[model samples]
Target: MDIRQLARGTVPWDRLERVATILARRYDRDAVRVEFLAADNWLSIPCIVDDEWFVKIVTKQHTRVHALLTAGRNAGALSSGSGGFFTRFETPLAMVEHEYEATQRMREIGCNAPEPIEAFEANGLGVLVLEYLPAFESVDDLDATRVRALAPELFATLATMHDNGLAHGDLRAENLLVADGDLYFIDATKVLPDRQAAARAYDLACALAILEPRVGVRSAVAAASEQYAAEDLLDARDFLDFVRLRPDHRFDSTRLRSELEKWAALSEG
Candidate 1:
């Protein structure tokens, strides 16, 4: 089994059946087809219902993992000379509900995101339902040329979120999807309300880290410069080393930092 599968744990077959039954009843169907996805997710058991609705079954274990990850992220923030900005949910339902609301907020702010249907508890498990995108590719799955073309829009969307007082506490290539030629964000994590600046810088750092490996340091920094000011980019620099520590992000941090500093200097001149 994959490491993520082990970390995500497994829901009992009967539990999944109960969830399917509940979904069938909620959707007014006699029965529903559940196709579990082998997603590299550590927080939930993701599945598709009748190829129409995307569902995430969040268990107690998932909540525990989320809390632990949040705590680690908080520590990372502290290392960047900022207070902890990441927030943890005490229950599975809270996790799903926050993600549901965050997705809605992103859409309300004119950003592309899947339509959140609902979040509810089924037999003590947190269940979140959303519209399924039949066709999409994660940024990580895209070619370098496509990623290069999409880089500016990615930063633009991030800027829009920041300008609207919203921050995607979790920003990574896998969390960003391209569907029908548009970028869609998913799985936004919770952050402290009063620590938007820290969260924003972290998000910027993650974006740069994601793009640098795909498009090179110069292109990544250039794309980021279009949406973020020199000072914003510099602030993001503080979080580069922290972001690099994540296994999901692999990039030449030293080179990326040099490129960012060069760009900032040129902007200052």
Candidate 2:
């Protein structure tokens, strides 16, 4: 029961058909029963590839885009006035392969990252079959009370990732899905090791703002940050440039900084 299924021809049927063929040949299953669990630029098709699985298929067109993106990243890294930005470009297939490696390493580090069951190049696309999370809900639909309770755990998970030198560049409510009161992260295209302090701080600040919809902005940033610091993740003042990036809602950066200053002074006293 997928929204796109009802509205056929809405998404790229040609791409799905092509990927389905590849899956059928690879898994020795019927492509006719291929169903999408979820998708964005990449298609998450549900299939039985020796067992229950969600196959994430990335199209060749997207890989070409990744190549272009890699070029851009290299240029940006070279042109960056400071040593803050990194310049590593990966092709689409390489990207999926790298993600698989990162997942294994992160698991060893005790971080909650999804692992791929199978990863390879197929149908001119990067095919990554991964273990799907069962019975989970994004924080967006959760209430303020529930979010407040989970807030500390969320920061703790982030702290673990940072301690191991990884940065989940995108930390939003959607990317954080809770199952049984624990957190698991997804969409890790930007997750990398040896990340800068600024990048890690950005992840924390954005996470606080993401909780704003569930809790008020100031309250979310302050409360979560208190645990974020007390948990030895980071000092609140480190998020001096804390600002909500989503233009739909404006959370004042100046107010955030001033509030953090007071929170720190009070903590010291």
Candidate 3:
């Protein structure tokens, strides 16, 4: 991946015009409108066709420290940006390709992820086209009981993926979309190689953290523990104890590790 070869600027009016042409050909003109969503260091023109689908042309800027910090934080990486900085570790083409491969693998394992349509590379730039998750809404829209009911199933799906050799770099509610009662993952730029137990535990903990604030802390912990144990990612008793000591008595890495160790012990037994 040539980090230096990243594409920038949407100065070329043809790209926008091309997108408009494509959308107008496919859908009702009344249903579609092209807007310059952002035109700063990066450009995004959204061709929204009614409420069903949106075609977003995302152009990348040179990797900035602030952007990397934000992305790292979102990915649950170490929080202190003061001690270090992020480099252009991967090319846009490579990142898109990695995501495409991961999406394909997830689909094969029956884990719901956005369909990869096409990834275009031109003039040292890349753009990924994915299935628009129109009906999809964030998990934040749901109440406690709904989140509780959803956790085990979500965890099970993630577990299936991890068990079959895959890892998601960002496992957060916003990145997850629910449509017609099915969860669909959107962002896939940072898929990792299999670390089944670690990945499952990490994702379960993150899910519990988000749910705990909305649901009762106890209920969130129980739901997380239930899924972790069901998947045999952790032991019930150890996870229960770990949960009790969680930062908010809910979910954290310390507790996650304890629970994972318990599961490892159980497996050994």
Q: Which candidate ranks first by TM-score, i.e. highest?
A: 1
Per-residue lDDT tens digits of candidate 1, residues 1-269? 87776777888999999999999999999999999987777899999999999999999999888988989988988888989999898888998999999999999999999999999999889999999999999998999999999998999999999999999988998999999999999999999999999899999999999999899999999999999999999999999999989988999999999999999999999
TM-scores, all models, native as reference: 0.97, 0.72, 0.64
Off by over 4 Å in 3: 1-15, 18-56, 62-67, 70-89, 191-200, 230-269
How many times do residue backbones clash in model 3?
0
TM-score of 1: 0.97
Cα lDDT for residue 139, candidate 1: 95
Residue 177 lDDT (model 1): 96
Number of the predicted model whose lDDT against the real structure is largest = 1
For residues 1-269, what per-residue lDDT tens digits would candidate 2 score against the true structure? 66444322132678667766876777776653555654443222334333456566655445545555445543433332212333232454766676676667667778776666777876556677777665678887788899888877787777777777776655677778887777777755453345456556656766766765666656766666544563222332344333343432345555655655666566666
lDDT of 3 by residue, 1-269 (tens): 43333343333787556655655555447335554434232223344444444444554453232256335443332221121111232454554555567788789889988777665554444455567666767776787677777877776776677677666645666667788898877554342333344444445555655665666555555555554554444422222333333233344445445545654566467
Clash pairs, candidate 2, are none
lDDT of 2 at 100: 71
Better of 1 and 2 by lDDT: 1
Candidate numbers, best TM-score first, in rank order: 1, 2, 3
Model 3 residue 240 CA deviation (Å) reads 16
